[model samples]
Target: MVNLDSSIAFLIYITAVSSAAAGVTEACKSVIPFLATDYEARNDCWEDHNHAARLNHYKRFFNLLISVVAAGVIFGVMGLDPALILTGAEKVYVEDSWEVGTWLWGIVAVFGSPFFASLLKIVEGFKQSVNNNLPPNRPRQKVTGPRE
Candidate 1:
């Protein structure tokens, strides 16, 4: 059985880990789109106003890019199954000695809040863009004439 203090420490550790995970999630959400959009806008200016082409030209707009690159390292260092880590829903066959459930649960709480906040922001951004019919990070286009 783990000591009370140790259990508390472990819980804190898990919370910290989850916070780190959340940070990465937010960073990826923000960075990837910024990169892709910038790339797409530049492509749009260079080429004709081919919105179709710009839309079709997909880019790696997520942390999956980094995760894929570090697959080997992540598994090697953590001694975890790469497949499991990649999936994030992996269950290991380790025996549970102490009741450290609180830590894992706490991690979810600590991480989930910011994640949801960021997600809401992203959603709001999308909603605004769609509502106004304008590109993100740019002013909404003015209505020129009556809609058909």
Candidate 2:
């Protein structure tokens, strides 16, 4: 029996499922900064500190929104793209290499979210190094618990 439902699910899996996953991956890649900060940075939003933080927040949101939508559209319409055509004496198989690649990318991105978050710090460090600037000296605190 040809399972039409299974076939449909498979199509969806390789298409929308992976693509949506990629979107989530992109969001994680984009929004890591909000999570990477220490408590001070978290509180800074309420402190009304200055930076293009508001702009950055918007930028991240749009990037995530676009990436997800684009991935969904691309994968759904293409159904595994950049295919490789292989021909034998009596058979031919067109392989969906692009689909596989995107699938792998989505999976890797999900697993690498923490690494992505820390990457923002590394990038900031490099930027600071290039610009010859350092964060202000913070007070030395001997903290034993959350009260500190």
| Candidate 2: 10-residue stretch with minimal lDDT | 82-91
Residues 72-109, candidate 2, lDDT per residue (tens digit)? 45543554431121111122122453445544434433
Which residue runs does candidate 2 get wrong by more than 4 Å?
1-97, 133-148
lDDT of each: 0.42, 0.46
Model 1 vs. true fold: TM: 0.28
Tens digit of per-residue lDDT, candidate 1, span 22-72: 455556667656433533344546464465355545333244333332332
Q: How close is candidate 2 to the true structure, as a TM-score?
A: 0.27
Output the number of the TM-score-best candidate. 1
Candidate 2: what lDDT? 0.46
